[model samples]
Target chain A: MSILEATRLVKRFGPVTAVNDVSLTVGEGEVVALLGPNGAGKSTTLHMVLGLITPDSGSIVLFGQELARHRVEVLSRINFAASYVDLPGALRVHEVLDAFARMYAVRRPRERVAELVELFELGPLAKRKVMTLSSGQRTRVQLAKALLNRPRLLVLDEPTANLDPDAGDRIRGLLSALARQDGSAMLITSHNMREVERMCDRICFMSHGLIVASGSAKELAGHYGAEDLEEVFLKVARG
Target chain B: MTAATPPSAPQALTLPPLSLAARRMRIMGVVRRDFAALRRSPMRMFEVLFWPTVELLLWGFVTLFLQTQRVPFVVTFLLGAVLLWQVLQKASNEISIAFLEDIWSRNLLNVQVCPLSSVEYLLGLVLFSLGKVAFAVAVMAGLAFALYGFGVTGLGVGLVPFVGLLLVLGWSLGLVGIAAVLRFGENAQVIAWSLVFVVQPLAGIFYPISVLPAPLRTVAWFLPASHVFEGMRTVMAGGAVPWDRMAWAAALNAVYLAATLALFAGALRYARRHGRLSRFGD
Candidate 1:
């Protein structure tokens, strides 16, 4: 069984169906990118997979357990990080990580916090309030929060939106290391096709809440007969 | 000195009550975050401290001028006025800010997505807001004691504890208002405007309840704050305690609080069912 799986997911807002009967899967150590334009239900599908929303119709399973009913059971082995929202700007960087670490109940949490701080190069900013950190630093703190649990399944939405390319590159490297070393699976939603191409083993192009196409980055590009993944994204979105 | 295992490493660790722990952890997380925010912005703490003092000053002066001469009821009224208003304002502002803050910065999504349930969220808000009210009330009491100089007499003791119930009742009402605000957003402003109308005059802040018109007096008797004011005056000024009357007020407040909590829970379920409990913080 996959670490994460969704079948025939649907979400509706009055007359508009935000996520329309979408199904997908992610296995151990795999990285899948949910690609689509704005309002194309990429985030919505992620939400259902994460068990944040009860699907109008369909099921999401994590380790063979249903997500909607077993969110907490699945949640400990899973954690999500996103840039749009944050770990409360008021908390100090160390405090935020300490708190999530405690939430995940990391044994001997202080050592775990120290390890993540060192791993993310977050030592310098530890004492400062999160609000005082720069955007890139905040993203790093968020990434640290997600990893605090040592989650087997990590869902990241636009994980590096505000960072400089250097910071972005470092993050990409860190995520690759996690997947390679820890056998962690991730489902990332990003508009940056180039980053997606570099990080993702497989990509699913979703449009109007359905998976229009699915394959590896190069495979998708060649199958769509486009020069790059971005063109494939544009082609899928335009359709 | 062992060669590093290929990146695909494996290790096993067991978990404890992850669900229950998540709720407690999330609430504690909120407390940590709020306290941190408080420290980072001394200006915000100052604003909270300053506004109550400023409002008290305004009403304190108004009471001084309006009294013509200090009748015993008016003196007692001023004390009740300050205490009761403090509780109401404290409760209203905190509950209002809870959901509004989430919507404001769009952190509602982050919080909702966590393993936080409606019961956990409500418990956190109640515990956190009441904790703030208690601390602020103590500070305000100290200020009042210093400024007013020992005026009222014996058994001024029970008054402090009695005032706590009043605070809870006021906050319960504020919570109900918060529910209405979440399910229907436009009413927030309307509720704000109505807050002043409902609380100030009817709250029996400026005059004795006996002096109010017969119908308004009947209405005032039903308010938990009114009984708190009356009970405080009885203990402080040797006025009548009116146990039967205070009993009724406590009873009414208990019912109101239960109803308010019910409403809040119902509203949450409705929002979730409607998908207005949106995960993206929309």
Candidate 2:
């Protein structure tokens, strides 16, 4: 079943069209990657999907309901995280997680927070204030917060951007396992081609506010006449 | 560190929609997050306690000096004005500062994208601000009695409506400040911190509206706070409750509240359309 269906989403900032005629969908348990160079309207598209930005013209259906009409009901079933956004810095790790767990109306908030604390290896850092944590540590905490609700669809923007290689690899592995074992759908944007290749079931390449190409990693590589996803990205981004 | 095993599958996706009780809990979540931050920051606590105490002391001494000049009932007038003005200041300042904290922490987007509606988020801020105002008022009232021997009870039952009107006016101004910040981004942050002061002269916090020049007095006439302060002075002067003044303030507040709420909603729409909210922290 389609977890999200966004059709012909267009957004403009004055004379600049940030996202134009973009249609995208994520199915149950499927991990989709949105890839593009800077200013490719990737973030705009993601924000529209999250209902943070109102599209100039479009329709979004989530879980087979119109998103505009059922925002609170639809949003309660999803969550988002981004490297550029932050949890409150003055709050302790556990407090931030607990607060979000409550915001998401999670059942058994304490247990959910404790479960995430262990899952993210945040046990030792739980008492530390969010500002005191390293960038990579903050990334883990954000991911943990994003899962507090056990959202059916998760939207992530550069989810592993700040993590060290070892931590990043573990997170990718954990996210893949979540999709495979838990049947959770995800829509993510990342510039890391290898990470996208490893985790995403399909990749959509965008440029100039439009999705120009989309396919599985191997198919995209073949369609672009490139050796790998990275070369394919270079070809699309440079065009 | 080794990766921990992933958790088991989530609960059924077709779970029931959020009930009204769950929605209220989400609002409380915003409040809890703020209170947790307040607990961790000594400076924030000090801000709540220190400034009100200092303002009271400053005005208390001024009234003491006036007493030497044989100014009859000056103590009640000056101290009463100080405390009432603080109520207005704290009520408005708390709301704007709470909003600013979210922007400064780069957490507005995180909060906005949740299931929490704008009205719920705003209600949380107003609720949190009321708590802060109550605490600050209690501290100020205590100090006023201990150090100056001036009791707010002297204002009698009139104090209730007086404070209520000021609070509504303050909330209206705070919403205006939030709308300004939303429309203009961080560059307009000064509106949150300084907008209250812009209304101070018109509010006639320490003086009668009649003291203003003709043009300014006309402007002050439309301000609900002016009627509140005028009514406050009448009460201190041993007159009746001035129901007419309170009525005027109440009616004005209704209009201001409606207009400011609409302004804030419109500004939020503009911000979302322009994608300014996503960059507010930057």
**lDDT, each prediction:** 0.72, 0.88
Q: Give the best candidate by DockQ.
A: 2
Give the least accurate 10-residue stretch of model 2 chain A, judged by summed lDDT. Answer: A101-110
Which candidate comes out best when scored by lDDT?
Answer: 2
The candidates score, on chain A by TM-score, as follows: 0.98, 0.99
- Model 1 misplaced regions, further than 4 Å: A103-109, B1-15, B18-23, B62-68, B150-157, B185-197, B208-222, B237-247, B273-282
TM-score of each: 0.86, 0.97
For candidate 1, the per-residue lDDT at B272 reads 59
What tier of docking accuracy does candidate 1 attain? acceptable
Residue-wise lDDT of candidate 2 within A79-125, one digit each (tens)? 89999998899999999998888788776678889888998889999
Please compute DockQ, using alpha carbons, for every candidate against the native two-chain complex. Answer: 0.34, 0.62
Q: True contacts preserved, each candidate?
A: 0.23, 0.62
Candidate 1 on B73-138: residue-level lDDT in tens?
A: 454457556766777777766666655666665566656655555665666676667777777766
The residue ranges of model 2 lying beyond 4 angstroms of the native Cα positions read B1-18
